[model samples]
Target: MSRLFPFHGGLKTVRHKTESNQQAIRPAPVPRRLVVPLRQHIGAIAKPLVQPGDRVLKGQMIGQAEGYISAAVHAPTSGVVTALDQRPVPHPSGLADWCVTVESDGEERWVERKPVDYHRLHPSELRNLLRNAGVVGLGGAAFPSAVKLNLSGHCDRLETLILNGAECEPWITCDDRLMRERAAGIVAGLHIIAHLLEPREVLIGIEDDKPEAIAAMTAACAGTGYQVRVVPTRYPSGSVKQLVKLLTGRETPVDGLPVDVGVQCFNVATAHTIHRAVDYGEPVISRVVTVTGQVRQPGNVEALLGTPFVELVELCGGYQDGVERLIMGGPMMGFALHGDEVPVTKATNCILAASAEQLTPDRPVMPCIRCGACVDVCPANLLPQQLYWHARAKEFDKAQDYHLFSCIECGCCSYVCPSRIPLVQYYRYAKNEIWAQEKEKQKAELARQRHQARLERLEREKQEREAKLRQKAPPRSEPAVAKPTLETAVARAKTSPAPTLETTAETVNRDG
Candidate 1:
């Protein structure tokens, strides 16, 4: 048994996990229409590869990875591309994004798959393969897994690799069910990751609430030298930084990644996708999602990417009465959706249909009592009250001084606030404003650079034109004759002198 370390400032919230994890994972039926978003992963949005009216096979790359930090987007099922246009996507802002709307042909046909042996392939090739396969962290961060696998500048050698099985969010149990049902597959995927990183030690972190998942993972890790460490059931323990601290006693830098601490963490679901991608030659076309809260049937479903949330709700026997809000993730960190029409993306892990009873009541906002409750429960060890003040005051720089970005927006602070202040919302607002300001600054800087370049280009062109004129003109023959000046004219008049009258009389006589 590996010893566990504790992180500071976490909440012991109610775990509504049993409501969803009781049942086995079910495969969701393909929807009649699938709306796939291209910007599912963290970096540049995948570039569209197909146009309207194109027939695509299931798992075919519909959007190719755009950059080193991007993941590909694929067809969820064999379908005809009906439209490549804007559609509502699963986001907190409830904004629409570019999507590939496909009308399923009901064929469910897949493209050719060629699995490779990881042992024989180079790490770069393996990372590239996973990148093309669209494998990202299904832990809800949805960061491209391929980018995490590369340890180039992060560290000389990886010390620890942690598989985060601690689905610590309330009412989210996709990872729990996945661990219970597909532990071996997850282990298989971890093997590939371990091969790539060659970490000194491999550890799997699970919360104490999940005994069955811990046992299942332990059994699967037998003879593999991987240790499954069960942490205390704490909200936000599943977060990378906290989990890293819990499993390895390493403090990830506030502005750096786990790799900066000689550790790297990935969600267990991400590992499973790696297994599927490398061993089965399949891409990330689907994921297991927890449909819980105010739902008729609360369970986990292996939902296809681009499948509408409504279809998964239907699969779970639809919504129960008093379903007040439809959220795309756990109540703690998830954002409420505008509607269920939005398609599931790589980042989606749960569909929470929260009823009034399941949700925190909308109490009137009151002034802060300075109770220090929020400060006590902030998992990131931040002064929540100060952050709230700064954020609410729109003092963004002060919020950054309070390490605003370090706050994971896990909602622990808000959950404990005595004033019922939506502290997290304020932080989010501040962060968004900061991001918007940063983007504007970047745009302004880019424009300035372009304008400077244009001015330089014009100056260079002007110089080139002058040089050409100088070269094209004929050379002066004899340093062209000088015009007679005042002094020269006076001198010439004196020299030409009195050839006048006397000379003129002699000249006239000769003429006569």
Candidate 2:
């Protein structure tokens, strides 16, 4: 065992996780309808496979992966496609996105299933299978798992594989419950990851708060030689970069990934899904989600993908009186969802029906007190005040200079701010501005390239036409000019010799 490395700064926030983790995970009843978003994952949106009125079976792929970084979408249950149009999705912006609405028939018929013999299959084939099965990072990023497994140009062999069981975000107990109940399945998935990456060591990093999870995972890993390293309970400890640094002493390069540091990470629930997809031929149709905070019965539920958040709230005995906001994910890093109508996607881990007290109370912004509390609690060791200044002033370049992207939007700075500044929101604005500017720059560059290519093509065509004309033109033989001597003139000049200049001009014009 190696010594654990410490991250720069973190907080000891409230752990509202116990309430949700106390109950056994229950299966959420299949909803009558599912609104499946095609662009749930963080890459190219999956192309729709079925049309309206088409009958789909449970586990059938409703959408196919369109690009390497995209994940396929499966039918959560047998149903008929009702609509393939824009609908309000669970996003911070309250925007509508493309979704497939399926009305379930209550039959729950499944498509044929064939489990893979992964040991005998080629690595590429295995990856494609996982893609079709629609595996993604269940830890909110929703990045396709196949892309991480490929590890192209990142490393030769992985040094470590860290499993993130540190559900540090308050009120999110899905992973915690998953670890305690399905430790064996999780370890089985770890074996699959080990076989794929062939890492030298496998480490599972769980927060010290989850003793039961740690013990269960420990017993499960006894014969496998994998380690269960209990990390100190801290806010944002579940973050991939922070966890990697804590467990392996390697800081992932800014703008890079864990793989760049010779390491890779996957959420524990993600690993369990991999095990199920390969061993049981099950696609990612359902996932465990935490339904807590201001609900009548707070706990975890294994809900099918596309199950409406409203239904989950109902399953938990409906919302309590005076519930103010509904947030997806946890309160710390999560975003406030517009309504409960949004359907669960791969990224849906927790649904927080927050009361006004449980939610971060809106406060009037005062001038920065310059108390430096944000600096002390920042997990990324960044200057929150400087970032706030630049972002507030719209000086995005300055914010970038201060390493704005390094800030993980952990809400620590905002949490500690005396003036109640929403620092994370400002940082998000700056990053979005930068990304938009970059995208415009790319579009302009592409247009320039196209124009340059057109100009070069025109020049080449002009040269080719000139060469063809030169080939067609007759070779000059000095125009057979006879000497002006008397005998030569009498013999050669019998007929009126055409004007050499005129004839040449005519020939050139004709060729032209």
Candidate 3:
């Protein structure tokens, strides 16, 4: 069994995590206002269902999923819709996106709820419930879980299930703390997933450095069919692809999902949320977030989604002055927000409010020297240098040919780059451009089809009109009775009513 689940490539990263794991998880105070971005996940942005001046209760669906892959957004607290406009989001570019700004009424009230016996329900029903509850991958990918679990009909074989509890990223301990404190919930969630997939076996992988988490998870799995496997602590061990390789001994093919190798991996936190959502009639209203780095009180907080970063910082005893950057998630893959005003969303697992000492300043970017460090650290084994060169030259097609989609944008290239170049940014730009171009192509194709259909209809109408005119014409057998000579025609006209000008004109006009 162990042979089937061998570990894979990873890196040793600095873990400045003294603040979070040292203490028990605590709930952060709710802020007076919350700014919830419509797009918190990796799919189509949810459309707002509420307008300004409307009131919303906690766990109320405020945004509807826009497309098949999108997830709905719930109101994090009982609040009034103060505004629905653009606001700064926690992004690498520090840009703004459409958001819902709500002023809290201090009533963390609950709406009506009902739990579904997920075990008794069909797989589709379970997936729909998960979708309605707004469950998504909590480890930062934010991919909708329903879309993932609905893959059973597409496959025939079941091999392994990997529960990723390896919180290997520095300064992020939300998953670690959850595994330690809520292992039962995690296990319960895993059971739900197991029921859906019904794989041959289950493996829960945790980093060895987190002994408490390991022990708790192991205790939870004692009599169950699940197996808790402790892996060496390494950066990116928690990544979906890497963890899949570590637990299944099967490498996911490029541009493929874990299911390609008859496997599935879910974040421990994501599993626990599934348990709560399906079994307890609870929606994903709040989540455990790690608030640390250069703050007076650095620790974990169970924060409501859409809680402002500033409020969280204040709860963590505020910054000690000279804070350089506010990062969402971890330093390795996390993005720096332009300001502390952005609110926490379902995807926000950690907020690292770092000072200069905590986070190094952005150095001037230099040219890549082909040292291959980026290639070495890349877990996906993609050619980062080649992709970087293509991106720099705006050769997007060449980049795609090199499997740009397989890059994973894990920030490994940027992290190990000697040039300090923002490789991930370039990759993102390329990806967006590609998507935009594909959309344009689709639009152009549809327009061409419409135009051709219209042209065909016009041609058919013209032909039909000509055919009807031909059918209505007198037959050739009805030719004029006599071919009159010029003198006979003139004598007939002269004798007919003395050939008045008006009469001759009317007769000729009528005959012609």
- The order of the candidates by TM-score, greatest first, is 1, 2, 3
- After superposition, the stretches of candidate 2 with alpha carbons farther than 4 Å from their true spots are 449-512
Give the Å error, residue 136, model 3: 0.7
Which stretches in model 1 have alpha-carbon errors above 4 Å? Answer: 453-512
Question: Candidate 2, residues 246-275: lDDT per residue as tens digits?
Answer: 999999887898999899999999999999
Q: Among all windows of ten consecutive residues in candidate 1, which has the lowest summed lDDT?
A: 471-480
What C-alpha lDDT do the candidate models reach, one value each? 0.91, 0.91, 0.84
Once fitted onto the true fold, the runs of candidate 3 whose alpha carbons sit more than 4 angstroms away are: 1-9, 93-95, 357-362, 457-512
> What TM-score would you give candidate 3 relative to the actual structure?
0.87
Where does candidate 3 clash, by residue pair?
none
| Candidate with more favorable, higher TM-score: 2 or 3 | 2
Q: The CA-based lDDT of model 3 is what?
A: 0.84
Question: Candidate 3's residue-wise lDDT over 48-141, tens digit each?
Answer: 9999999998888888887889888888889799999998887777889999988999988877778888878989888888888889999988
Q: Clashes per prediction?
A: 0, 0, 0
At residue 44, what lDDT does model 1 achieve?
91
The positional error of residue 199 in candidate 2, measured at the CA in angstroms, is 0.9
